[model samples]
Target: MKTQQRVGAGPGRGLAAALGATVCAAVFTAAALPGTAWAAGESPYGFDGGAQPIKGAATSLDARPLTAGQSYRDSIKKDGKLYYRVDLGTQENAYVSVVAVPKAGGAAEYGDGITVTLQDGSGAQCGYQDSSFASATFTRPITAYAHRTIEPDRSTCQQAGAYYVLVERTSKAASPPDDWQLEIRYVPEPGVTQNGPTELPENWPSSSPPPPVGGPQKRQGGTGFHDATSLRQGEWRADIEPGQTLFYRVPVDWGQQVFATAELGSSPTGATGYVPNALVLSLDNPARGHVDQNTVSYDGKPATLALDPHRPVAFENRYSSHSTTNALRFAGWYHLSATLSPEIVKEYGDRPVQLTLRVNVTGTPKAGPAYAGDAGPFQVTADDRDAAASGASGDEAGTNDGMVVVAAAGIGAGTVLLAGLGVWSFAGRRRAARDAARGGPGGPQDGPSPFGPPPPAW
Candidate 1:
């Protein structure tokens, strides 16, 4: 019945087709909208050539405390850097990540690269990582994780006191950027108690990790946090810009396990120009804690991630018995964030990269244990799961029909676009094959015998 709501929330194909036709008719009857007028030879999306020097913008270092399962959203200017404070216990681990989104319209291109540094109160650098934008089009989130202390000794940053995180732009622009949205995610590792030899679970390395079981692939629709698309069981297809990031949420009841794989589609000519080691697929728990993460190069390979309750421990933190043993403590909405770096966009321009997503959400929702305390902010309702997946607003009941219609139209349009892309890709491959066979002056296969065996060294 619950899964039905996810699928039935949107209109059927027949209704969507009919509605699309009606919408197209309405569009034809209306006058065409005028195109945007801009100054000649100036970048339309860039600043209006009125960018000010970065030095002029004043910034104050304000360190805000970060907590587990919390994301702080703010903005930073081109010349400015944002700082946050984080405190760690000797027994706990800390993980931090920053995601930057360009502000709409009148934005100046602040080339790739944003630097994040972790330092102590005395200004000593601890651990830092710099994340470059995939392209001006999109940026993949950058992350860093560290424990309270290292055995032999690495950096002074691994201590029980206060640590600061600094985020700044690495590229300079003619005009100062208005601001870019930054989402900071912090995860506090669960503490572990040294219990005797650690009663190793049967799922531990005593047995090899199971290989991912191939399943149906599904399409993703939401390309950002605000519009993450809903997903159900089945094969789906979609296209993404080279540097685009997509968010999708799935409902996992108590005792459920989720497995997903993301694969890059071959280019039009069956060869992607350059692959960047920037495709990252991350899974977050209901509380927004970093449960697990994986990064893979888009070199025509699939990246797979599975949250099997049999082994909730992330490969990186498996040594920590406490965190891994209790990783799956919640049963609610799990968020999946998938991103491709801008290098693809830079090399391919507006050409879309097709992606096939395979998702397996198994298990039924079992009744949770009764709570003795008062109902806090989270009472856990049946609708909570679906609401998060749908990005539904407060007045969902009133706009159910409208939302269904809109979603139907969107899904229909997405399918048609994919079809067009497939045809274009096939045509490109055919043309390339024909050109190679011809081997004419302009063909890529021209003059292939130039350096064969150094002319037999005669």
Candidate 2:
């Protein structure tokens, strides 16, 4: 019996979902995973004990390509065809050992009973390779402490990606009573990650590619280099075929203090049809200069961006399978921006930043005519034409006169101080409730004026 599982592969749309197969050890999972990172310096385990034929039918460019270990002389009188490969025999960052099919031909003598199964090339089956049967098998095979965690199902296989084997025949019968051989053991990185860390830099390439500048033509002008290999390795994928429109020219700074931040990547085939991802920032550099743009649809692998806050300008495509490409087939790729907050050249002074990137292909913008610069010259005078047409003023007529009567006298003094604070707190709470309903000294209408001092003169 034999078994290995680490699941986690996805499927559903424009692509991106399939990564989870790095179990490395219940018996042998080949850990250090990154979508299936188990290259433990060459051998995660693909079997070499000797029976042969277990790696996904063969070398698997699509499957079927092995030759050194295959033998099946009519078992169930039918079953045959297997493949596996991985014998680095040497290390130093090198990898590819093999092992992921688990059982089909020998092992069973008391009565010829053996069952080893482990699948994920999309046949499903994953639970029954008994070390004891408490659940799935694995009391042996895949040495160096163990290994067997491959999850490749070909939608582009990448649940943990890294693959190289596919052994099959999970029923085992027709010739055998013992002596099972399939033990791939090659320890140099037993726990994995034996030498891959210093923070980052094994090949150090995710994309820092910055270099696409060629501005200044001025008269309906033109220059070059728009993603020039994204400077040779920073992410600039291409596979277009929509309307095809990709052009670049950035040196924007035309007049009008700016503050830029551009990021727009879209993909739409239908839904009223808009296809966003456009960035234009053109003024051809005259003062501020900003060109941040967007237009995503090589399925979302666009480029050109940097704002540096220490690294605060962005536009990523998340690409790296050891990338090395530039096959140009445009349909969409845009990212434009403008930022220059000193009031954008303080109103036109540094004249020297022109921009013109094109990409709206079938939707309209192939960009052609637009050239005319510097406009400044005026002379009206009639007291400057009554303060430019009548905000009328001899010396600024009464402080720009009646701004709606000063906002209605400041809303009538805040409505008379809130009606005198709501009538002095409601007349001081009704005069303390009429002095507590009069339970005090003077009663009988409260003395002092009864026919008055009549007997006082006697």
Candidate 3:
């Protein structure tokens, strides 16, 4: 297919690059403004995450219970399909994600695939998806999440109450009998809050089309930004094998813009009919809503695909090119998910593909409006440091009040020095303690994810 069009050239592209750049710039400028940093409110709707391990699949008709706004992880053996029971409210949205990890010394075949199904209590099927290795050998972790049920008004599975999640290997026997790790989390989005950003930037170019791709630029990482080993201002490195998907989370504040590119290491030798676009990188906004998708094509050299929103962050119109609207309307932990083409793995054999993921986060985290209700555990206003202190239950002291007070004192003292210091210094002191309790850097564990087409039938 031809490369993506320039921003705002097509329908809905009006929210094109202009929206991207100007919105990001305005957000950042607002953040940098004095006394605006601490006012940021956290998003009230998201994963109400509390994880519990599934001991094993229930035998017979018995299914393990899964709670909404919680997460569960466990291992399942080959040919073993685990079933879990879910009880959801009529207004609540349910999501489930299953990640299949091949055991050490296992076949390591990237073509291995799995099937996940959601069924209502009365034996009616609600939703189902099959994920494959996609013909690549160097496999990374394969993950998939989808809403368990259609919206309440929909015809199918409309009622709330008991539902089932079933997971089983779908790949051929040649792949080997490896144990797979299953991370399952069900998120219930509180239906009460408004679904869009607090505000849109002025002079947002509502009438004009977006310009061409902006050239590359440099970005600097803010201090105390590395809490979850998240992608920062500069570039980060990762290795992905075919059939495997790697995930990285970058915290973007209300005003900041985020741009990322995945450079595939090298094309496999003697591979033919292989599409140059061997890699697929997807961006999910803070609420785990998919925003953009791009691919790295391998011509003679490593093909780089810009995986940012169209216009403002990068020059390419990935929104139109990918045929998906950019839904990056909010701030928080936007996730970068990378996967390789199975065709490459089929030809190259299972081998690690070196990749450089260049992530650019521009703008600053300005304070957000304080909502009437408590924000979930995840806060977009605070960086990794504050997120760490909040922990899963979100019971940290001096949250919004602490930051604002400290920042005000620093400003009065006539120094951005203490401004930065006040924002992160105390938070940094809690880092060691938080890390010890929360464990190391990890991606979002909750499972509700975008539902899309499965791999083509063989």
State every prediction's TM-score relative to the real structure: 0.45, 0.18, 0.51
- Superposition error at 286 for model 1 (Å): 2.7
lDDT of candidate 2?
Answer: 0.21
Q: Backbone clashes per model, in order?
A: 7, 65, 22
User: How close to the true structure is residue 140 of candidate 3, measured as C-alpha lDDT?
Assistant: 40
Candidate 2 deviant stretches above 4 angstroms: 1-84, 90-92, 95-163, 166-211, 215-239, 243-272, 275-458
Best by lDDT: 3
Candidate with top TM-score is 3
Ranking by lDDT: 3, 1, 2
User: Could you tell me which residue pairs clash in candidate 1?
Assistant: 51-175, 134-342, 135-342, 217-235, 217-236, 218-236, 219-236
For model 1, residues 167-215, the per-residue Cα lDDT tens digits are: 7766555544456656566655443333222233445332222333433
Looking at candidate 1, the ten consecutive residues that score lowest on lDDT are 1-10
Better of 2 and 3 by lDDT: 3
TM-score ranking from best to worst? 3, 1, 2
- Per-residue lDDT of 1-458 in model 3, one digit per residue for the tens? 11111111075565445444433443344234322222343111111122345764654258878765455667777667778777776654455666555532234444466666677777666655455545434344444444443332355666877778777676566666656766566654433233223223333222322321322222111111111234444444556665545556665654456678777756556344345447877665443334566666554356677754432321111122232222343345666777666556556667877676676555434444233333352245334433422331121222322333334434333233334344444445544454454343322322221111221111
